[model samples]
Target: MPSSAGPSIDTITEGGRVTQVGEGQEAEESVPPVMTFGAPTAGEILAERYELVEHINNDSAGRLVWRGVDVVLRRPVAVVLRYPGGDSATEMLQAAVAASRVIHPNLVGVYDAIDEAERAYVVREWVDGQSLREMVADGPLDPGRATAIGNAAASALAAVHATGMVHGNMHPGTVMISQEGRVVLADARTDGADSRENDVRAVGGILYFALTGHWPHAEAPLRGATAGHGRAAIPDGVRDASGAIAAPRQVRAGVPAYLDDLTMDLLDAGIAPPPSDVLAAELGRLDIPIEEEPYPEPAGPLRFAAETGDEPSPLASVGGRKVAIGIAGLLAVALVGLLIGISALGGDDDPLQTEPVARPSSSAPASGAAPAAATRKLSVSDVRIIDPDSKLRDELGGAERVTDGDQDKGWDTDTYTQPNFGNRKSGMGVWIDLGEEHTVKSVQVSLSATGASAQLFAGKTDPPSTSAGDKLLFTSYRTNPVGQPFEEHDGTTMTFNGFDADAKYRFLLFWLTALPSNDRGYQVGVLEITVQGS
Candidate 1:
């Protein structure tokens, strides 16, 4: 029988019985062993492919977690086994299956789920790092790191929510941070009791925990407790006599004002939590380097409003910044109006024209003009791969690397048989969102290889961050290219200065028409992209 205080593996006896020892507790005497009749033991093989190696521990819900290996694939795996298959393990199995469908870098990959009459087990990617709960054990994390973890969790949940499914389980335990600095969300328990809104709110809990080393949801305990069953290993949020939990900033020093506002807003029941994607984008924007200030000096506490149909609430709009959620349609309208105004001014040639013009050396306001609208590097709020024709969505994983200010790491397309994406559906590109509209300037793209045919397009509206949305964007942008298309450019660096000086642009699509030949085949890599505008 599993103890009330979560089980920790001390040793596996030859009889296939696991010895449970509590952390910091010493074994004084040889304890009597419990029945091990139906329990899976060390060295047992399930599904003929997964060979159980070591028992990690038993979770709060009496599920056995083992560090296993896929004999066939020769990869380490985490095997979660629950006794008595059938109805008892329905929720676990279902959640595993659903999670398996969504493949994301920040989401732990669910390999296989099986039922062996007496027991049910789920085999998933074995993360080699500690959980958020464990990471914060020493102390709260820095605001930057906490923000990165929040961004990763939110991004993973956004991908999961895109499939119209709720994660139902987003907590410190589920948020895994690997040794390689990879943050992945694992152990989704979509038990139908939780809503998508709840999932979004859980991100707040995660952020709060990361910043304060305290679990906010004390009343409603999350999964994975190192000690007590159902209770989190982390301490509860510092609450007052009124039972109101203190904000992160109040608990920890150096927590950015915007991050504090965002975390508290998500935890606030009164204020609605932004959609996962919107929250993810906001977090991504905040996940900046320590050298750069996270946000403008705070005016007041930021708040979120209930999302109305088609209209999103003002999400993370602090210090008068216009960070509205789901404004793609409105952006499109704004773009259309701008184009019409430009067309009216430009004497009949379609304002939405794609004509190659002489590339300017600089976007600086010509000699002797008002100090050129102080060109600054505009931050990208969000980015996604627009692979409309591809069946595999695997390419969407590293899209963030292109803008991470790291040239060595980048996002690249799969190698193709031919230069033009193996002659498959037009071409694929990256979609970029600049949070809000900005004035005209130049866009610089750093590529890994030269001679790849590419085009830069600026759009008014943002699209849903999905495959279908990618298709719609691809079709729309291809029909009416914004700037001149670069056909077989000579070098890796490409600059587009065709942006209208007076026009304000928000979204951009960097569409690739062809690829450069590599040692493997034909492929192109976007090392880094920088937008210089007001």
Candidate 2:
């Protein structure tokens, strides 16, 4: 006899057995076909430890995902159950075992795999987030956000590729973003059905989807993604009547050319996909930080060999600086020569200047070069907060506060529960637009508190509404206790230097990567920004 509080038992007269009854009972009882499969009901415990609480959704691969509880541990879990399963059970278990062997922050952890003869299920960590497919259901994503998502996926796939294993299945359906702003790849099906190139290419597909709201790769096995009228078709690229898939820029207005090229290159079957590690490295390089590095003093200018054997050359003892300056000079001369040739072609041929003009002296700076160690402070405009959540955005003054040359008045970030901005969003940043591009030498920042860390990033394009990693300049960053000057640490001043003098900087961003301390809660004030450039 079962108590009223407990689950009711139902007798299957045909099998002469008593079965537990719950949500799926009616469906199971109505089925009189030869292959009678019993559906798992709510509160039914499988393997004695997992209790199914609610059905989430069925995957395209024919797996039922249920929100369940580990009866033994009392922890929530996701249980993927497959019914009327035999060979599929074997494959699922194998995948579970394979996935379990490789542990990565981006991968969903497998807890257990078991079969009950009639059905099979694989228990895994429950992610508190939405899938990539769900994210773009409303519309396309920002290119920078899309690129960041792809970078994370590529990094995770690189780890799997390192072990000679493949994710086998890579699609928007498998990408997940937690509530804390962490991106992770999930539901890996490693059956060798897909090649490593396919995985890499899928990353491009993700980018395209994020940029265009449509999957570019027709062959990607994603639900709600098809090739016909509005969706991308299989195998062939996302195409129109012209039989060519439009580049991201063609689909959207603000997608950067570099990003468009990278996405197209990945989707183009004509081009071989780069190795996963190489792709990861490329993305890593493009991710620019906005924080400044302590700028060291400039090295000496170039020197040359002395005409007389006994006399020391003016450029002697020029070690590393020599090579850098030499390269710069050579490049300048080549550019000048090319320009002169073009000009000569367009003008009347003058025999007096038939030959190329003499190149600048090895010791002399190029005609266009700024005075040695010339520095200028730039005034930044259009400062803004980078919070992604519109409702949660903090109110701050326009770009003028930090540039007003007033330490007493600065911009403060919204207080967060955790040092890392509570992981609810990527860390906030203060972005500034230089009126025009310049050859930057270094940047100095003044902050209200210590221990906050930031990296500097420069790009011609407007900084995206979010803090994008692909636009970072150098990974080298600056950090310290704010307002607390120590023996060598100037508590109020954070200096960033060693910028590549050859590269030009127009728009600058100072993005915080970590908060100094949560003792006072997570917030930092941008007091001032002093840029050194020409």
For candidate 2, give the lDDT: 0.50
Model 2 Cα lDDT, one tens digit per residue, 1-534 = 100010011111112321111111112222232223787789999887889998764433334557789999998866666665456356555545555555456555557767666776666666566556557776777655776788777777776677676664455645667666556665343545446766777777777777787766543233222332112221233466745577777676776545665666566553335566656655553443213332121221111111112322222222211111110111010011100000000001110011111111122335796435423355565666544433435444554787776767878776777767777655556667777777665566777776676665555555345324322321221231111111212244554544554666766667676666546677778887766555
Best by lDDT: 1
Q: Residues 1-534, candidate 1: write the lDDT tens digits.
A: 110110011122213443221111111223221223566778988888889998766543445667888999999866666667666655455545544556567765556667665776666665566666667776898888888898887787776677676565555655667667877665443334446667778888888889999877766633223343223345888887767677787787887665676676677554445567767765675567745765333322223432122221233233221121111000000111100000000001110111111111121234785542434567899988888887777777799998887878899888899998888758888888899899745566778887888887877666686778777777776665554567887667665544555678888888888999989999988988777666
Q: Give, for candidate 2, the lowest lDDT window spanning 10 residues.
A: 338-347
Q: Which ten residues in a row have the lowest lDDT in candidate 1?
A: 338-347
What ranges in model 2 sit over 4 Å off?
1-38, 60-63, 84-88, 219-241, 288-534
Candidate 1 TM-score, C-alpha based: 0.50
